[model samples]
Target: MRIQLTFVLLFVAAVLQAQDIKISTKDNDLKLAALPYYSYGKGLGITSADSLFQLNIRFRMQNRIGFIKNEGEDDAYDGQIRRLRLRFDGYVGNPHFLYVLQLSFAPGDVGEIHDGENINIIRDAAVIYRPNRNWSFTFGQTKLPGNRQRVNSSGALQLTDRSINNAKFNIDRDFGLQAYYLNEKKDQFSYNLKAAVTTGEGRNWTKSPDNGVALTGKIELFPLGSFTKDGSNFEGDLAREKTPKLLFSGAYHQNNNARRTQGQLGDDLYQQKTLRSFFADAMFKYNGWAAMATYMSRASHNPVAVDPLDPTLTNYAYVGHGMDYQLSYTFPTNYEIIGRFSTQKANKDIKAFTPDTNEYTLGVTKYLWEHAFKLQAEFTYDRLSFNDGSTKNNWYVRFQIEIGI
Candidate 1:
C-alpha cells in the first residue's frame, strides 16, 4: 500500500509542480514557459523559448465496459479501468537527444505478485539520439521492432481493443537498443528500416534471465509516397489523403533460447527453445478509405519435452500463425466505421493443446477530438476449434472511452 501511495503522490506532485513553474525571460535568450493543455488531459508542458529543450507531462486513461457470452455458458458482464498512464517526454540539452518515460498506475496493470504489491509501474523509459534526419539510435526499454499493430500505441487503436492474434503473438516490449534509418525523396519517404537487439524477457526484468537475446529487423517501402501524416502508424484515414498512398512492410524476429513461457511476457519456461517469427503487412489509403492486412507466423525449433518423472507434464513455446485484415472509412463528421477479420491456427504439432480460432469484429468510433478524446464500441464474434473436431463459439460487445492529454 505504501509503495502504491508513493507512486500516486509522486505523480500528483509532478503535475502540481509543472503547473506552478513560472515563465520568465532572462535577456530574451534564456526563456522558460509552461504551456497547459487540455486536449487529451489537463497537464502542463514546459519548453524553452528557443525550442532547444522541452518537457511535456501528459496523462491518459481508458475506461471500458463489456459483456461476453461463451458457448453453452452464462453471459458475463464487467467494467474496469482499461488503462491509466502517466507520460513524460522531452529533450534536455538538444532536440537531437530525446527521452520518454511512461508509467501505468492501474491495479490491472500489475498482476498478482508473490513478493509484495505489484508496483511495477514503469512502461517505457528510453532515450533516443538523432544525429541526422535519416538515422537515429534508441537505448533503454520500449516496444520491440515487431508487428505493426504491436508497435502502435494502444490509445490510438481504432477498435475497442487489439485483435486476439496480437495478444497471442505480439512481441510486446523489451529492454533494447534500436537503430532506425530512412531514405526520402522530395519530402516523401521511399524506404525505412528499423533493427533492434534486446533481452528476450519482457519489461521490469533488471537482467537477462537466459544466455540468449532477441534480434528483430523491419523494413518498409512506400511505393505511392509515404502515408499522409504518418497514416501507416495510425488506424483510419484521418488524414484523408488527397492522393493514393501505399506501404509495404516486412519483419523477421528470432529469440535464441528464450526462457519465458510466452517468449517474452509470461512465466519462465522450464526448458528453453529457439523461437522464430516472420511478418508481412501492407497498407493503402485513398481519400477517407483505408485498408490494412498483416500475416505473422511463429515457430519453435524443438517441441516441448515431457517431464522425465511425469508423463503428463510438458513445457513448450506456442507455435502458430495468424492474419488480420482491417478496413475503415472516416466520414466528414469525424465518425469512423471499421471492420476486421482475424484468424490464427496452431501448428499441427501443437494442435492437441492449442486451439485454432477466428474472430470477426465491427466497430464505430466517434473522434470528439481526434484520438485524444474518442468513443468507440465494437462487437466481436469468436469461433474456436479443437483437435477433436469439436468447436465452440463465443461473442462479446465492448464500449470504451479514451482520454489523453
Candidate 2:
C-alpha cells in the first residue's frame, strides 16, 4: 500500500512540473515527443527537444509457470510474476550527465522488513558522468562490477533465469562510486577497466552501522574486437557475427569487516569479518553460436562464531567455490537452443551445514523481437550432497514470456 502511494505521489509531481514548465525558442529548439512501445515490456517515453533534459518511463514484467519435484515429494505447480519493474532514466542539460531510477513492485522483491518498512521499490538510483569517450564515473546505488552473468540485466537473459552459481557468488548491488576506462583499437582489440568503492550493505539500507566498505576491480580484453551493439552484455549471438569475437575478463572484490550474513545481502551478522571474492570468465561468438564459461570463489576470514547465549552454539558464514558453462545457438528464424552446467561446493573445514550441488539445464527461446519480446522454456536437474553423506535430487520445468517496449 505504501509503495502504491509513493508511486502516485511521484507521478503527480512529474505531471505538475510538466504543466508549469514550458520551453520557448525562435528556431523551434524546444520539442515534445512520446514513444509507446511493446515487445518484451510495455511502456511509454517522453523526450525533450535537442535530446537534452529528457525523461523516459518504462514498465516491465515477467510471468512464469513451473513445476518442481523433489526426490520423494509430489510435484508442485507454481505461477508467479517473477519481476515487475518501473524505470525512469534520462539526462539533464548535457548528455554526458545521465541518471537512472528504477523500482521493483513484485511481491518477491520485498524482502524482510527493516526500520518498519519493506523496501520493494528503489532498485537503482545512480548518476553517470562521461567526460569523454575513454573515461566515465558513476555514483549512487547500482550493481557492483562482479561476474559477467550478474551484470547482465535480468530482462535480457536468454534463459528463464540465471544459473545457481550466479545466485551463490555474484556481488549483487550496493551504494558506491565507480570509475571506468576503455581503450579500443578499431577492429583489432579493446581493453576495459573498472573500479568501485561502496558500502558493503545491500540495496535500500538506510544506514551502514558496520562502517565497512567493499572494493572491486575488473578488467576485460576483447581480442577480436568488441561485440556489436553492446553484445558482450547480452547473451546469444543476436548479431550473428560473420567473424569470431571473443572477450576475456577477470575481477576481484573484497568486503572489509562485513556484517551481512551473505556478504552484501541477507540478515546482519552478529560479528564483523572480512569477505573476499574472485571471478574469471570468457565469452566467444561466431556466426550464430555463442558460448561462455565462468569460475567464482568466496572466502571469509572468520567463518564460524560462538553463540553468546549458549557455550556450544555456533554460526558459520557461507564460503564456497563454483563454476558455470553455457552455450547457445540462434537460428535464422530467431529461435535459440541453450544448454548449461554448473557445480559448487562449500569449504570442508566449516562445522556448519554446507551442501555440494551440481545442476544441468536445457532451454529453448523464440524471439519475436530480439530480447524485447521472447518466449522461453527450460528444464533443470539438480543433485545435492550434504555433509552427513546424504544425497538428494530434484528437477523442474518452467516456461516464461517477456514483453518490453
Candidate 3:
C-alpha cells in the first residue's frame, strides 16, 4: 500500500514537471492543459505554426502486485512496476513521413541482460514513410509483425500480461525494415498485409552478429467489418461498437541461424539453429462484448543443440505449441468482467526439459476514463503437468493500477 501511494504521488510530481518543462525559446511547455483539466490520451500534442512538423508526447506507468500459493510449497508474493515508458510520436518534413521514439524506465521493462549488458532503455526508434493511404514502409528498430498479441501495445491489454504462447514463440522486436498495405471499404470489407526483415538478434544486442536474419509476414482480414476507433488494437470493446466487428489474422516467421534460445530472445545458444514460427488468431467485438482466440506453434529441424565432446553442455529452443482464448463483457457503467483459458504443450524436442501447463484466469477492470485511468484485479489457477507424470498446482492473485496520458 505504501508503494502504491508513492507511485501516485510521483505521477503527480511528473505532471507538475511536465507543465513547466519548456520545449522552445517561446517558453512553451509540454503540458496540453493544467492537470485536473486535460484531454484523454491525446498527451501533449504540439504542432508547428506552419504545419510542417508535429510532435505528440505521452507517458504511462503500470504498478502491480501479486500473491502466489504453490502446492506443498511456501506461499510467495511478487510486486513491482511492471512498465513505465515515455513516447514521442509525430511527423517530420511532412505528414507523409513520420517517426516515433520510446524509452523504458522500469527495471522489469528492460528485460533480462543479453549480449552482456543491462542498459536496454530504448524501446522503439523507428521512422515510417506512408506514400499513400494504402502503403507504408518502416525502418530502424521496432516490433516485428509476428503475433497479434505481441503487436498490440502493452498499455491496452485486457489481462495482466500476454499469454504463455507469446512468451515462448513470439518473434518480438528487432532492428528491421517493414512494408505494409491496407485496404478497407467503410463498414464492409478490409484487409491488411505486413512483412518485415530483421537481424536475427533481438533488440539491444550491440555485439556483432553472425549474418543471420529473421523474416516475418502477417495478414489480417475483416469478414464482418472493421471495429470503430481501431478497436482491434485494444483488448476489449471499450468503444462498444453498435454493429458487429470481426477480424482474423495469420502470421509466419522464420529465423535463420538463430543464436538465442527463444529466437530473437533468451540466453545465447551454444550452436545456432533455424527456427520457424506460425500464428493464427481471431478477434470479435459487438455491443460491449469481446472475444479473442489465438494459436501459436514453432518447428525446428533440431531444436536441441548438443556439444558432441561435452555431453553436459546442451541448449535448445522452446519448440512447442500453445493456445489462448479470452472472453469479456463490459457494462455501460464502465466496469468489465473477463475470463481466459490458456494452455501450452511441448514437442518431442524439448518435452523433457519443459512442462506442459494449463491456466485459468478471471479478472475485473474499472475504467474511469477509458483505459487512460483504470484499476484491474485478477485471479489465476495454474496447473503444470510434467513429462515424468508429476503435476503441480498453484494459485495467483494480482491487482494493478494504470495511469497514462
Candidate 4:
C-alpha cells in the first residue's frame, strides 16, 4: 500500500511540472488551439491541440463486404467493422516529444473469438523525440523502417495490401528503435531516409533475445519545379506540379540464439537465421492516368521438418520473391477505372509457406452526394501454386460504400 501511494505521488509531481512549463509558454508564446477539425480522406492533415500540453484523438471505421469460394463452400457475406481504430497523438511542452498510441479493437476481438482466445497485444504505442526538423529518434512498439511498400500504411496504399514477399518476410510490425532523416531542399531533389534496429521476430516482442538487431533503410526521390506564374513561393509545390517519384529500400536481419544440446544425440546445434530483402517501386502520374509497379525479393534460412532417424541433423536453406503492378485512369467526373496484376515465385524446398501466386483485378470507384460518400466495386481472380504440385483458383467480388462527416 505504501509503494502504491509513493508511485501515485511521483506521477502527480510529474504532471505538476508539466503544467507549470505549459503555463510559462502560454504567457509569452503562440497559443495553439485544438478540437472541431475536419478531415477529407487521409492525407495532408491540419489539426492542432488546445494548448502545448493537450490530447488529440482520431477515429476510423471500415467495412468489407465480399463473396469468397473456399475449397468446399461458397461463402457470401458482408463483413462489417473490418477495422475500428482509435488513435491518440500529442506532445509535451518542455520535453518537446511527440507520441502516438493506436488501438485496433476489431482485430483484437476477431483474434480472440477466432483463434482460441490466444493472448496477444495488437495495439502500438510509440514516442518520438525530434531534436530538429532534419533528424528524429523514435523508440517504442511499432512497425520497423523497412521497404517503402511495407512502411506505407494501408489507409494510404493504392492496392488491397502488400505483395507476397512482404507478407513472407513478415516485416509487418516489430518492437524497435528508429532514427529518421530528411533533406527536403537538397539542390533540385529531396529525399527521406530512415534506419531502424529491431527484433527479427515479427510482432513478437516478448520472445526476442537481446543478441541481434535487424537493420533496414529506405531512400525516395522527389522532383522539384514550379507551376504558378508568380515567383512568390520559395518552398515549391506538390499538387499543382506534375512529376514522377521512385523509391528503393532494402533490409538485412540476422539472429543467433544459444545452442541447444540433447542427451541422446551427444551433439549441439544452434538456431541462427539470416534474411536479406530488396525492393523497388515507382509511381508516375500524367494527365488523368496514374501507374505504379513494385518488385521485391527475400533470401532467408528456413529449416526442414525434423528427421526421426538422426535428431542431431537438421536441414536449412534460403529463398523467396514477388512483384505487383497497378494502372489507374480517372475521368473528368472523378470516377476511376483501375486494373492491377501481381505475381509471385519462391524456392521449391520450402512448403510451410509459398510465394507462387498470381492475381488479376479490375475495379471502379465513384463519389456521390456532393463527393462526401464513396461507392466502389471490384472483381478479383487469384491463382495459387504449391511446391507439392497442388494448385487452386478462386474468384471474388467486393463492394464497399464509405461515408465521412
Per-prediction tally of clashes: 4, 7, 0, 2
Per-prediction TM-score: 0.86, 0.86, 0.88, 0.71
Tens digit per residue, CA lDDT, model 2, 178-213: 666667554788988877788888787775366677
Better of 2 and 3 by lDDT: 3
lDDT of 2: 0.77
| Candidate lDDT values, in order | 0.76, 0.77, 0.80, 0.51
Write model 1 residue lDDT over 265-302, tens digit each, in one string.
Answer: 76556677788988888888888998989998888866
Supply candidate 4's per-residue lDDT for 160. 39
Question: Where is the poorest 10-residue window by lDDT in model 2?
Answer: 29-38
In model 2, what are the clashing residue pairs, if there are any?
Answer: 39-404, 40-372, 40-403, 40-404, 41-403, 41-404, 41-405
Model 4 spans > 4 angstroms off: 1-50, 71-78, 108-110, 113-122, 163-165, 185-187, 208-210, 223-272, 305-319, 351-355, 367-373, 388-390, 402-405
Q: Which candidate is the best by TM-score?
A: 3
Please report how far candidate 3 places residue 336 from its true position, in Å.
0.6
Per lDDT, the best of the predicted structures is: 3
Better of 2 and 3 by TM-score: 3
RMSD of each: 9.6, 9.0, 11.3, 10.2
Once fitted onto the true fold, the runs of candidate 1 whose alpha carbons sit more than 4 angstroms away are 1-43, 48-53, 116-119, 184-189, 305-311
What is candidate 1's CA lDDT for residue 297?
Answer: 86
What's the residue-level lDDT of 265 in candidate 4? 11
